[model samples]
Target: MQIGIIGAGGMAAYHAKGFTLAGAEVVGIADPNKPRSEAFAATHAIPATYRTLKEMKTQHPNLDAVSIVTPNKFHASLTIEALQMGLHVYCEKPPARNASEMQAMYDESKRAGKLLMFGFNNRMRPESRAIATYIEQGEVGRINSAQATWIRRAGIPGFGGWFTDKELAGGGPVIDLLHMIDLALYFMGYPEPNCVLASTFHDFMGNASFKGPWGIADGTGKMDVETACHAMVTFKSGQCLTIRNSWAEMNEREVVSTTFQGTKAGGKVERLFGIDGVDETSVDSAVLYTEEYGRQVNRTIITEKDETMGRIANAMNFVKCLMEGEKPANTPEEALILMRITDAIYKSSETGTCVML
Candidate 1:
């Protein structure tokens, strides 16, 4: 299994490491910035680098797949192009700018008879994997409602970069921190949503004090995206989901968590951070709330700590699905649905009314 990587940013390293760990050779890397691509390739021990995907493919004609780690604006176009070239694609998430783009990518993949998977990595977390098994075994029955949140006390990625520019990054934390939302939906069995009521606030849009510690290069682009978004989605099955996401808020600490209410039991998977994105300063836990012999009980579900937060594991799954016949952890269909819900959330926020799917 030979792979080509798109984008030479921080995430490309993770994909390179993951594919190599899964026994897939990363043959080449491509990025608009040649120096960055070369540096990344050299660091990862990749043999080649190119200025574009076309050039990479021309050089490595037998490349089996490509992992896209580009910005939100490039995900759909690149995925569609890669699939058209007869290569499987593993794209980083917020699937695309809108559902329409996601649908086009999905359609292209099907037309090309290739695989399309997104980086909804939360599904690969140890706690999430365990919770999924419990749900599958009927321990947590019929999830009725869920709340997904990724709130940071002062954790904006950058003050005025692509992340803060709505045109480039799609939206703020609602789209950027969508992992929790996807995780909640995955646990709910990916039900069809009926409608969404959402509101977005830009209170700290350009505040440098809220910048995150990741050190992504800051740009002088327009800082017009939201700082916080709150939304309620009701599903066709009558189940409900509430989403709360913010890069900057008046909170005590950074929290990434999802809690669900089920028929027989309830459960929560959470990570609390003293400083956002620093695993060493983070605490992880999973708990189940249920009754035994009519007595209320709580069970602490323990799992190994994953410092990478499943990012590498998610990439590995994509390779395994193609080379070892493993089922995909996430499908293009699920990604399209996630994007549709995301579109509705933004529309609802703009219209100040419920948006139907």
Candidate 2:
């Protein structure tokens, strides 16, 4: 399969690598910055570069698919355009800046009859896959309550760049942390979210000690987004999930973990990797707690680093779906639901009241 990347940043490079790893051709790269695009093409050995998707389409008309790794603001427009061009899209998380745009992308994908998948790479992690399989196998029956978090001690990305710009990034860790929330909801079978109550904090925006590793220094750029967020999501099935995400905080350990409580058994998936690599580097693991012979038993499932490359798996799945007519792992419809919940969470935080979905 021949593929192209829509951005020249770190994520776009990552997707290019994944496609190469899957033995697919990365024909072109599209970025507004010519130097960045040229450098990426040189590094990735891609033969073509374009200033925009339109240029890429004109030059590489045989492209089979493209990865949309641009910022939140461009997600909807770029994704819809790619779909309309009859190209399958693998968009980054959050789907779009808002739910309305996400709906348009979804509608366009259906109209174009192409596969649209989100970069829910966390779900493809070996630990996450194991937990999902466990839940599907009824090992953890009917999850009722869950808490998912991705916390960083000082791990903001691009302090004053698009990552911290509300207009470009949409929001802070809440928007960026959609992967963790999506993982929780995915394992919970995607119950309908009834409402959301959320709060955002920007306490560390201008703090020198909290500046993260992704942006420029000197601190002269605008930082209008939150550094931390907390949310409570209620589902129609009477199940609830609490999300806690932060780009900066006063903590020693950093973690991306989720704990699920089910009627039959309880399980936890934990990864010590932080946003800025503060936490210990170890294998991601999932633990199951169950009563065996009237005694509590814990089973640990450890996933090695080589076990799964979620980004690669996602890319391969897209290729396979096109070639074999297989079903997608993450659908645009599911992504739309996630965007609605995310919009509600942000609105609730802004209005200081619960927002109904």
Candidate 3:
């Protein structure tokens, strides 16, 4: 497959490398930043580089697809455009600012008969998949509720300006650190969420002065987006999930994690306190501690895989679907549901009421 990247940022580089590892030729990369684009092209040994998607599409007419990793605000427009141009799209998550825009992109994908895959990387973690499978297999029996959190130790995106800006990021931890919702939904097989209520806070911006992997934010950083979001999501399955996402929290360690609360089997972070026995293998994502049969039992499953694993695995699945002429795992239509719930979270935060799906 001949792939072209829509953004030459760090994620685009990871996508390019992972694609290469997956035995696909990264034919080119397109970015508005000429210097960054040129540097990426040189580093990846990609023969083609362009300043715009229009030019890339014009140049590489044989390109099979485009992997978009631009900001959240640009995802919908770019995805629709790429789909209309007869290209399959594997776009980075937070697909749109709102559900309507996401639905439009999905509709266009249906019209174009192209695969549109959302990048929710948490789905690929080995432990997460294992436990989720176990839960489905009745290990968890009937699930009642779940609570997930992505907490950082005063770790606001002290990096690029795009993240803190509401216009560019669409929202804060609600959209950016949304893997918890996706993981919980995946474990629940994408249950129909009836209503969502959330409260968001921006109190930690004063402690946002720090170095970050994507670089640093300079000057007086005005965080116009939410730094924390605590939401309650209710489902028609009678399952309730509490979601906590925060980039700025005074905590001991960062949590890239989630949990599933069930009647038979409940799970939390697999191995929180250093690896030992089953506890160690579960790593950060999953932890199942069950006490039954007149005994205390603890079975840990470590999730060491990073977010990129899910993105790449989902992409590969999408590509296979394109080859087999079938629907993908993370389709644009399904992603619309996620986006709608996300919008409702923001609406609920603002209105101090539950936003129904």
Each prediction's Cα lDDT score? 0.92, 0.83, 0.75
Q: What is the TM-score of each candidate against the true structure?
A: 0.99, 0.94, 0.89
Q: What are the per-residue Cα lDDT tens digits for candidate 2 across 4-118?
A: 8999876676677777776678899999999989999999899989999989988888988999988899999999899989898988877898889999998998899888988
For every model in order, what is the number of clashing pairs?
Answer: 0, 0, 6
Candidate 2 deviant stretches above 4 angstroms: 214-221, 274-280, 306-309
The TM-score of candidate 3 is 0.89
Candidate numbers, best lDDT first, in rank order: 1, 2, 3
The numbered model that scores best in lDDT is 1
lDDT of 3 by residue, 270-346 (tens): 32422111223334545687887888787867555553545566666655665555446665656877888899999
Q: Which ten residues in a row have the lowest lDDT in candidate 3?
A: 270-279
Using TM-score, give the best candidate's number. Answer: 1
Better of 2 and 3 by lDDT: 2
| Clash pairs detected, candidate 1 | none
Off by over 4 Å in 3: 209-222, 269-285, 302-311, 323-327
The total number of steric clashes, by the backbone 3 Å criterion, in model 3 comes to 6
